[model samples]
Target: MNTTILDMVKIEVTKLLAVGIIYPISDSHWVSLVQVVPKKYGMTVMRNQHDELVPMRIQNSWQATRKDHFPLPFVDQILEKLARKSHYYFLDGFFGYMKIYIAPEDQHKTTFICPFGTFAYTHMPFDLCNTPSTFQRCMTSIFLDLL
Candidate 1:
């Protein structure tokens, strides 16, 4: 594959928001140009600087198979325990805007390839193994006194 062409196509799609068109150039070769869209679902393929292929959103396929057995408190239980409270302070943006950093050495594990180029995430992404558990662990550590 002519990766240069693929890279250029990716850049146009991502940076320029251009629409992609596919055409069969030869009996054995087909060329496709695509536009990058905000991901609601599905997977994207990207390359790293090492010219490796990384597939994004592949976690969607395995998400259904993951089991949650972490020792997290149930919401109902917390509510029951706090029933005697006179006033309650509701905290907004508890987990909504939290940022988790990824270790530099492990950032490569989060690398993904796009038609334009390969990139790595500097922060923890939503779609990763044990993400919920990891987040829960962090939240627990932060709110240990409250919990």
Candidate 2:
């Protein structure tokens, strides 16, 4: 399915209105995986600049084998967009680390710093600053790319 401009505007407005409100999931059979796709391409590498390993872009990152009604691109897209807008696109957290998947033909020697240590390998590209504004800029880049 294609994304619409109005849809994106609504999403942004919603997030702006709801900053710090996390909902709790209460389902015994609800499980999902959040993948982190690096903006850059290549092998995992450490980045002292960000003080952590880079993470890859989230591709098939989130998975829900069985659930009541799992949103397809919406879920991932929303989270990813939020991350990007909130400067958490790299899936950076303080719990675990992410892994890297380097393609043979890839040639981008860049790495990102997972915000919360949620990945194994480090092969994501990151810009300086790394703040919510930074994430917004990144999100804009992605939108432009899609166009």
Clash count, one per candidate: 7, 27
- Give me the displacement of residue 16 in model 2, in angstroms: 37
| Residue 38 local lDDT, model 2 | 29
Best by lDDT: 1
Task: List, residue by residue over 34-61, the lDDT tens digit for candidate 2.
Answer: 2232235632222343333322233377
Q: Residue 126 lDDT in model 1?
A: 48
After the best TM-score superposition of candidate 2, give how far the Cα of residue 82 lies from its true spot, in angstroms.
13
TM-score of 1: 0.45
TM-score of each: 0.45, 0.17
What is the C-alpha lDDT profile of model 1 across 37-72, one tens digit per residue? 223464343233433222223344653224555776
